[model samples]
Structures are given as C-alpha cells and as structure tokens.
Target: DTAVSQTPKYLVTQMGNDKSIKCEQNLGHDTMYWYKQDSKKFLKIMFSYNNKELIINETVPNRFSPKSPDKAHLNLHINSLELGDSAVYFCASSQVGLNTEAFFGQGTRLTVV
Candidate 1:
C-alpha cells in the first residue's frame, strides 16, 4: 500500500481559477505538512499540522489554505490562482520526533497559464 497519496498528479489551469489538491497518508503519522518546490527547485514548507492542530505556517499568501480533516489527511485549496502559484506541491507525513523520517507523495504539479 502507498504510504502517502495525492490526487491529480498534474494540474493545468488558468489564472484566477480555483483548484484543490487532496492528500492522504496511511502511515498513521502524527504530523503532516504541505510544501512547495519552485522552478529553481527550492523546497519550502507552507504549512504543518500535528494531530490535526496547526503547528507551523510559513509566509504564504492568503489565497493558499490548508485543511486537515484528520490525522491521516490534509488538503490544499487555492483560490484565485496566479502565475506565481505554478509549482510542485508536495504532501508529507512524519511521526514528529527525533530521527523520524517523513514520507512524501509524488507531488502535484500545478501549472497556471
């Protein structure tokens, strides 16, 4: 079974459109995160949740929202998508402790025209 999974491996949309990406992890991890990899391949954490509680939230735009229905699922919703939003979005999960490894999904590539 896949440890982590995301829907719509590829997404193509126009500017000002709204879209959402769904993610789920079966590893039973206590912590989950949302990351963004830009064109330059710089990976940055956008949001983090521990046991369904918001923990870390980076300096992301208000258009980006992350929702965790439970410990195993975290979803991202983007409103009024912009060209800058085009990047690889990654969903990851970890046990939240020292030396704990994080498992990541294949990523959802979002492209805005």
Candidate 2:
C-alpha cells in the first residue's frame, strides 16, 4: 500500500516508438499529477486531474498525452517518442492547496535511443 507508485522504474527505447507510464495513488487525494524530471533535475508538472477533471496543463509535446480513468490513477501515453522525451517521468499527488506537500513516485526513466 503505497501513496503513489509508478511502474517500470527505468525505461530505455528507440527514438520512434510508443510507450506508456502508469501512475497510481492511494492517499485518497482528489488531485493527482504527472511530472517530468529532466537531466537537470528540474521537476515540471505535466498534467493534473482533480476528481477526473483536468485542472493544470503544462506545455508538453503533443505526442505526450495523459489519461486519467479515475481519481486514483493517471497514466501517460507517448506516441512516436523522440529523444527529447528521454527524461524521468514521475507521478505525484497533492491536496488542493499550495501548502500541502506533493508526493512523488520512484519515476520511470524513458530513454529514447
């Protein structure tokens, strides 16, 4: 029973392939998010869905799309993945307040060859 978890902690692939990263949270939080941690360790929020409704959307590539089936899970699906997408994809969650601390998963490192 983890608060937030992501699968395939490491990912390495070719430049033009399709891949997906899965995220899940069991903290009973209404808002869940996806973040991309670059080589510089900069954590940028990609998508945030609250109660199945999208709230925060960042400037990400069109090939990268986030799908949330429910409040407990959010998944990232990438099509025609590029080398630029080679970064650590993290799943995070936080309460609907800035004061709340955001929790993160171990992350999946997607490497495009």
Please name the candidate that would achieve the greatest TM-score relative to the true structure. Answer: 1
Q: Which stretches of candidate 1 lie over 4 Å from their true place?
A: none
lDDT of 1: 0.96
lDDT of 1 by residue, 1-113 (tens): 99999988999999999999999999989999999999999999999999999899998898999999999999999999999899999999999888999999999999999
Model 2, range 1-113, lDDT digits (tens) per residue? 78899998998988889999999999988889898889999989898899988888898888988898999999999999888899998999888876888889999998999
- The local distance difference test score of model 2 is 0.89
TM-score computed on alpha carbons, candidate 2: 0.95
Model 1: ten consecutive residues of lowest lDDT:
53-62
Candidate 2 runs further than 4 Å off: none
TM-score of 1: 0.98
